[model samples]
Target: MNILAIESSCDDTSAAVLAPTGVLSNVIASQSIHIKFGGVVPELASRAHQTTISQTVAQALDESKLTLDAIDLVAVTQGPGLMGSLLVGLCFAKGLALANHIPLVGVNHMDAHIYANFIDESPSFPFICLTVSGGHTQLVHVKAPFEHEILGSTRDDAAGEAFDKIGKILGLSYPAGPVMDKLSKEGDAKFHKFPQALLKEGLDFSFSGLKTSALYYTQAKEDAWVQEHLNDICASVSEAITEVLIKKLKRAVQQTGVETIAIAGGVSANSMLRAKAKKMADTMSLNLHIPKLSYCTDNAAMIAITGKMKAELGEYADMNMKPFASL
Candidate 1:
C-alpha cells in the first residue's frame, strides 16, 4: 500500500510518501521564525503549518511521482504535540481520507520516533530505545510494531530540553541543543561536574535539578569567566545528560536482558550520546541501532513508515479522532 503521511506536530510542517520498499519522498518545512524567539511560538507554528502543509504534501507526492489516487492510506500524528499544530495536519489528513475514500491512521509521535530505527534496519524484537527529544525523554521496550513498554521517562525537563535550556543560559542561539552539541566536542567534559539525578528504583529520569544546577553555577561566574569556559560548560552539561541516560540504559538492558539497543528522537543526533552508545554497545556486546541524522529529528518519514505498519495491522482511526497536546 502507498501511504501518505503528514507531520505538523510542532514547528515543522512535513509530509512523506511510503511504499512497501521504503519511503519515497520526505519533505519538511521548518519554521525559522522560532529561531529568533529562542523557542517555538505555538500560534506562529500553527499558522506556518497551515501555510506550508498543502504545498509540503504536494511536494512529497511530486517527488515520489505519485498522486492522491495512489495513496491508499492517510496517516497523521494525533497527539503528544502542540494542539494547533497537530490539528492542522489531522484536519488536512482527514480531508484527504474523506475525499479519496482512503483509510486513516493516527500515530503516536513518540512511537514513531522509536520506529524510526526500522527505516534503515530492523532491530530484533524486545529491543530498547532511548528516545531523547526536546519535549520528552524515555526508555522504551519495543516488543512489536505497535507493542511498547515504557521503562523510564523524564520526571521534569527532557534531555534535549535541558540542552536547549542550558544553551539559552549560555547565550547560544535558539534551539541551543545542536549548538551545545557542536561546542561540546571542542572542550573538556570533565572541566566541571554537573549533578546527575539517579532514580532510586526503576528506570526514571530527572533533569530539572541539573538545569537548576547549571543556572546557579553560571550565575556565580562572571560574564567573562563564563564566556571563556563556554565550551567546557557545554561539554560538562552534555556529559551529565548522556551519563544519566547511559546509566539508565545499562540498567534497562541488564534488567530486560535484551541485547538489542537503539536511540532515537532529536537528541539522538548528539555526538556524545552516539559515541557513548556505540561504546556501550561494544562493551555490553549488544547490537546497536541508530537512525541517520536526517531521521533523528521530527520528520514525516518516520510518520509514514509507522503509519504503514499500522495500516498493515488494520489499525485505523475514525474521522472523529481529535488532536491532543500530550499523551
Candidate 2:
C-alpha cells in the first residue's frame, strides 16, 4: 500500500511517502522566518505551511518515484499542535482523500513520535519510550502497536522548551536546542552544576525550576562573562536536563521492569542524551532503540508509517475530522 502523509504540526512543512517495506521519501521545508522572533509564530507558521505544502508534497512524490494516483491512503497529523498549522495539513489531507477516493487517517502527533522508532527497527512489546520535544516531554509505556500508557510527563516547561529558553538567555539563535547541544560538546558538563528536579517519587518531571535557575544564572553575570563561558554554560544546562531525564528513565525501567526502552522526539537528538542513554542501557543490560536524527524531529515519515499501521486495522477518519491543539 502506498501511504502519503503530511505533517504541519508546527513550524516545518513536511510530506512523506510510505511503502510496505519503509518510507520512500520524507521531505521537509523548515521555516527560517521564525529565527528573528526567537520562537515560532503561529500565524507565520500557518502561512508558511500554506505556501510550502503543495510543493513539498509534489517533491515527496517525485522523490518516491510515485504519482498521486499511487497514494492509496492519506494520513495527516490531527492534533496536539498549533491549531492553524494542524488545520493546513488536515484540510489538505482531507481534500486529497476526497478527490482521490483514498482512505483518510488522522494521527496523533505524539503517537507518531513513538512509532518513529519502528520505521527501521522495532522494539519489543511493553517497552518504555521517553518522548521529549519542544512542546511536550513524556514517558510512555508501549504495550503493543497503537497501545500506550503514559507513565509520566512534564508538569510545567518541557525539557526542549527549557533548552530553547535558556539558549535565548545566552543570546543564541532561535530553535536553540540543536545549537546548545553542539556547544555542549566543546565544553565541560561538570564546569557548572545546575539543580536537577526530581518529583521525590514515581516518574513525573519538572523543568520549570531549571529554567528559572538558568534565568538567575544569566542575570548574575555580565554579557561579557556569559559570552566567555557560553560553551560551559550550555554544557552545564544540557547536563542538568539530561541527568534528570536519564535518572527518571532508569527509575521507570526498574519500576516497570521493562528492559527494552527507547527515546523519541526532537530533544532525543541531543548528543549528551544519546551518549548517556547508551551508557545507562549498557549498565542495565537493556535493549535500547532510538531513531536516526531525521526521525527524531517533527517529520512526515512518522505520520505516514503510523497511518499505514492504522490502515491495516481498518482505522479511518471520515469527512468530519477536526484538528485539536492539545492531547
Candidate 3:
C-alpha cells in the first residue's frame, strides 16, 4: 500500500510518499523567515504552511512517480504542535481523504520521531529510545513496534530549548542548536562548566536551571570578555547539555536492561551528541541506532512510515479524533 503524509507542526512544511518497502519520496520546505525573529512565530508558521503544503505534497507525489489517486492512505501529524500549524495539515489531510475516498490517520509527532529509525533500517523490539527535540525530551521503552511507555521526560525546558536559549545569550539566530553544535568543534568545551540539574529521581530531566545558569553567567561576564570567548562559551554550554543527556540515558539503559539504544528528534541531529552516543554505546557493549541527519528532524516521511506500521497492526484512529497541542 502507498501512503501520503503531511507535516506542518512548526516551522517546516514537509510531505512524503511511503510504500511498503520504504520511503518513495520525501520533500521538505523549511521557512527561513523564522531566522530573522530568532524563533518561530505561530501565526506566520501557520500561514506559511497554508502556502506551502500543496506544493510540497505535489512535489512528493511527482518525485515518487505516483499520483494522489494512487495513494491508498492519507496520514498527517495531528497534535503536540502549534494549533494553527496542526490545523492546516489536519484539515488538508481530511479534505484530501474525503475527496479521494481514502482513510485518514492522525499521527503523533513524537511517535513519528521514534519510527524514523525504522525507515532505512529495522531495529528489533524492546529497545530504549531517547527522543530529544526542541519541545520534548523523553526516554521511552519500546516493547513492540507500536508499543511504547515513556519512562522519563523533561519537567522544564527541553534540551533543544536550552541550546536555543543559550544561543540567544551568545547572539545567535533561532533554531540555534545546529549553530552551537558547529561552533563547539572550534572551541574548548571545558572553558565553562554549567550546572546539570538531576531532578527528583527516575529518568526525568530539568534543563531550566542550566539555562538560567548560562543566562546569569553571560550577564555577569564583561562585555569585552564575552565577545572574545563566545566560541568557548558555546562549546562549554553544549558539552554540559550533552553530558547531562548521556548520563541520564546511561542510567535509563541500565535500569531498563535494554541493550539496544536509539536516539531521535531534532536535537539528535547534533554531531557531538551522536558521536558521544556511539562512543558510550560501544563502551557499554550496547547496540546503537540513530537516524540519518535528514531524518533526525521533523518530517512527514516518518509520520507516513509510522502510520503504515500502525495500519499493519490494526491501529486506526476514528474520525472523531482531534488535534492536541501537547501529549
Candidate 4:
C-alpha cells in the first residue's frame, strides 16, 4: 500500500510517501523564522504549515515518483502537539483523502516516535522502548506491534526540555538540543557537576530540578567566566542529562528483564546519548535499537508507518476524528 503522510505538529512541516516496504521519500520543511524569537510561535507555526504543506507534499510525491492518485491511504498526526499545527495537517489530509477516495488514518505523535524504530530494522515484539523528545520522556513496553504499555515517564519537564532551558540560559536560540550537543563535544564532560533527579521509587523522571540548577549555576558565574567557559558549561550540562537518562534506562532494563531495548524521538539523535546507550547495552548484554537521524525528529514517514501498522490491526479513524492538543 502507498501512504501519503503529513506532519505539522510543531515548527516542522513535513510530508512523506511510504510504500508497504518502507519510506520512499521523507521531506521536511523547517521554519527558521522562529530562530529570532528563540522559540516557536504557535500562530506563526500554523501559518507556515498552511503555506508549506502543499509544496512539501508535492515534493514528497515527486521525489517518490508517485502521484496523489496512487496513495492508498492518507495518514496524519492527530494529537499531543500544537492544536493549530495539528489542525493544518489533519484538515489537509482529510481533504486529500476525500478527493482521492482513500482511507484516512489519524496517528498519535508520540506513537509515531515509537514506530520509527521499525522504519529500517525489524525489531521483535515485547521489547522495552525509551522515547525521549522535546515534549515527552517515556519508557514503554511494546507487547505487540501496535500495543504498548507506559512503564515510566517524566513528572515535570522532559529531558529535551531541560537541554533547551539550559541552552536559553546560555543565550542559545530555539531548538537548542542539537546546538548544545555540538558544543559539548568540544569541552570536558566532567567540568561541572549538575544534580541528577532520581525519583524515589518508580521509573518516572524529573528534569525540572536539573534545569533549575543549571539556571542558577550559570547565573552565579562571572560574566567573563561564563563567556569563556560556555562550551564547558554546555558539555557539563549535557553530560549530566545523559547520565541521568542512562542510569534510569539501565534500571528499567534490569527491572523489566527486557533485553531488547529501543530509543526514539528527537533526543535519540543526540550523539552522546547514542554513544552512552550503546555502551550500556553492550555492558548489560542487551540489544539496542535506535532509529536513523532522519527518523529521529518529527516527520511523516513515522506517522505513515505507524498508521499502516494500526490499520493492519483493524484500527481506523473516521471523518469525525478531532485533533487534540494533548494526549
Candidate 5:
C-alpha cells in the first residue's frame, strides 16, 4: 500500500510517501520569504504553498519511485493552522483522492506530531507526550492508538512563541528559535535568571509573562550590551522556558504515574530541552522517545504515517470534509 500525504499547515510546504515498512520519501520546500518580516505572513504563506505544493508532491512521489496511480491513499492536514495554507493542501489532496479514486484521510496537525514518534519508534501505551511548538504547547496522555487526553496546555504564549518573540527582541533573525538554540549552546544558562510563569500552577502553562519580562529587561539594556551577551541571554531564556516545561512534565508523570514518556512538535528539537528530557528520563528510569529533527517540525511524513494508521482502522474522510483553523 502506498500513502501520499501533504502538510502545509504553516510556512513550509511538504509532501511524503509512506510505504508499509516506513516512510519511503519525505520532501520539504521551506518558504524563505518570511525571513525579512521576522515572522510568518499568512497571505504570503498561503501564496507560497500554492506555488510549491504541486512540485513538492511530485518530488515526493519521484523520490519514492511511485506514480500517482500507485498511491492507494491520500492524506492531508485538515487544520489547527493557517486557514489559507490548510486549504491549499486540502484542495490538492482531495483532488488526488478524487482523481485516483483513492481513500482520503484528514489528519489533525497536532495528532500528526504525536504520531511522528511512532514513525521511528513504538512507545509503550499510556505514555505522556509533551508537545511544544510555535503555535501550541501541550501535555497529552496517550492511552492507546488515536486515543489521547490533553493534560495541560499553554494559556497564553507557547514556549516556542516565547523563544521567537524574545529572540526578536535580541535582534535575531525570523524564526529565531533555532538561531537562539544554537547560540545558547556556547553560553552560561545562569547568566541572567528569567521568570518562570505559573510554576506552582497545575499542568497549564503561561509564557506571556516571560515574554513581557524579557521585553522589559531588554528594553532597559543597550543594544551593544544585548548583542555582546547574546549567547548568555539566549541561554538564560532557554533555561527559563525549558525549566517550566520540564517541571510540568515531571508533575504530569507524578500525577499520571506513566513510566514511558516522549516529546513532540517543533520545539522538541531544542537542544537544551532534548538534553534535559534525556537526563530526566535516565534519572527517573523512564523510557523516552523523541522524533528526529526532521519529524520534530511540521512535515508530511508524520501526516503520512498518521494517515496510514487511520486507514488501518477504516477511518476515511469524504469530499465534504472541510479544514479547520483551531486546535
Candidate 6:
C-alpha cells in the first residue's frame, strides 16, 4: 500500500510517500523567518505551514512519481507540537482520508522519531531509544513494536533547548545546535568544565543548569575574549551535554540489560553525541541504530513509516480525531 504522510510539528512543513519498497520521496519546506527573532515565533510558524503544506505535499507526491489516486493510506503527526501547526497538517490529512476513504493513522510526533530508525533498517525489539530533541529528551524502553515504556526524561530544559538558548547567549543563530556542533570540531571539549546535572543517579536529564552556567560564564568574559573563544566554549558545552547523555545511557543499559540501542530526534544529529554513542556501542558490543540526518528532524517519512507499522495491527483513527498540543 502506498502511504502518504504529513508533518507540520513546528517550523517545518514536510510530506512524504512510503511504498512497499521503502520511502519513495520526502519533501520539506523550512521557515527561515524565525532566524532574526532568535527563536521560532509560533504564529509565524503556523502561518508558514499553512502557506507551504500544500506545495510541500504536492512536491512529495510529484517526486514519488505517483498521484493522489495511488495513495492508499494517510498519516499525520497529531501531537506534542505547536497546536496551530499540527492542526493544519491533521486537518489536511483528515480531509484527504475522508475524500478518498483511506485509512488514517494519527502518529505521535515523538513516536515518529523512534520509528525513524526503522525507515532505513530494522532494529530488534527490547531495545532502548534515547530521543533528544528541542522539546524533549527521554530514554524509552521499547519492549516490542508499539509497546513503549519511558524510562526517564528531562526534568527541565531539554538538551537541544540548552544548546539554542546558550547559543543565543554566545551570539549564534536561532537554531544553534548545528553551528555549535560544527565549531565544536575545531575547539577543545576540555577547554573548561561545564556542569553535568543529575549524572550520578537515574536516567533523568537536566540541561537547565548547564545553560545557566554558560550564561554566567560568558557574562564574566570580555566581549573580545568571548568572541575569540567561541569555538572552545561550544565544544565544552557539547562535551558536558553529550557526556551526561551517554552516561545515563550506560546506566540504562546496565540497569535494563538491553543490548540494542538507538538515538533519534534532532539532537541525535549532533556530531559529539553520535561519536560518544558509537564509542559506547562499540565498547559494549551492542548493536546501535542511528537514522540518516534527514530523518533526525521533523519529517513526514518517519510519520508514514510509523503509520505503516500501526496499519499492520489495524490501528486507525476516525474522523473525530483531533490535533493536540501535547500527547
- What C-alpha lDDT, on a 0 to 100 scale, does residue 296 get in candidate 2? 96
Model 5: lDDT of residue 75: 92
Q: Write the per-residue lDDT of candidate 1 for residues 1-327, one digit (tens) a residue.
A: 898999999999999998887889999999999988899999999999999999999999999999998888898999789999999999999999998899999999998999889987989998999999999999998887778999989889999899999899899998999999999999999999999897456799999999999999999999999999999999999999999999899999999999899999999999999999999999999999999999999999999888888878888899999998886
| Local distance difference test values of all predictions, in order | 0.92, 0.94, 0.90, 0.90, 0.95, 0.95
lDDT of 6: 0.95
TM-score of 4: 0.97
The positional error of residue 89 in candidate 6, measured at the CA in angstroms, is: 0.5
Off by over 4 Å in 2: none
State the RMSD for candidate 4.
1.1
TM-score per candidate: 0.97, 0.98, 0.96, 0.97, 0.99, 0.99
Name the regions of candidate 4 deviating beyond 4 angstroms: none
- Residue 157 of model 1 has an lDDT of 93
Cα RMSD, each candidate: 1.2, 0.9, 1.4, 1.1, 0.8, 0.7
**Residue pairs in clash, model 5:** none
Candidate 2 lDDT tens digits, 122-229 = 789999999999999999999998889999999999999999999998999999999999999998999898988874667899998888999998999998999999
Which candidate would rank higher by TM-score, 1 or 6?
Answer: 6
- Candidate 4 clashes: the total is 0
| Position 16, candidate 6: lDDT | 98
Residue 290 of model 2: what lDDT? 97
Per-candidate count of clashing residue pairs (backbone under 3 Å): 0, 0, 0, 0, 0, 0
For candidate 5, report its TM-score.
0.99
| lDDT by residue for model 3 (1-327), tens | 899999988889999999877789989999988888888999999999999999999999999999988999988998899999998888888888888898878889999999899988888778999999999999999999868899899999999999998898778888899999988888898998899788336788999998899889989989799879888998898888888889889998889898899999999999889999999999999989999988999999999988888878777766676788884
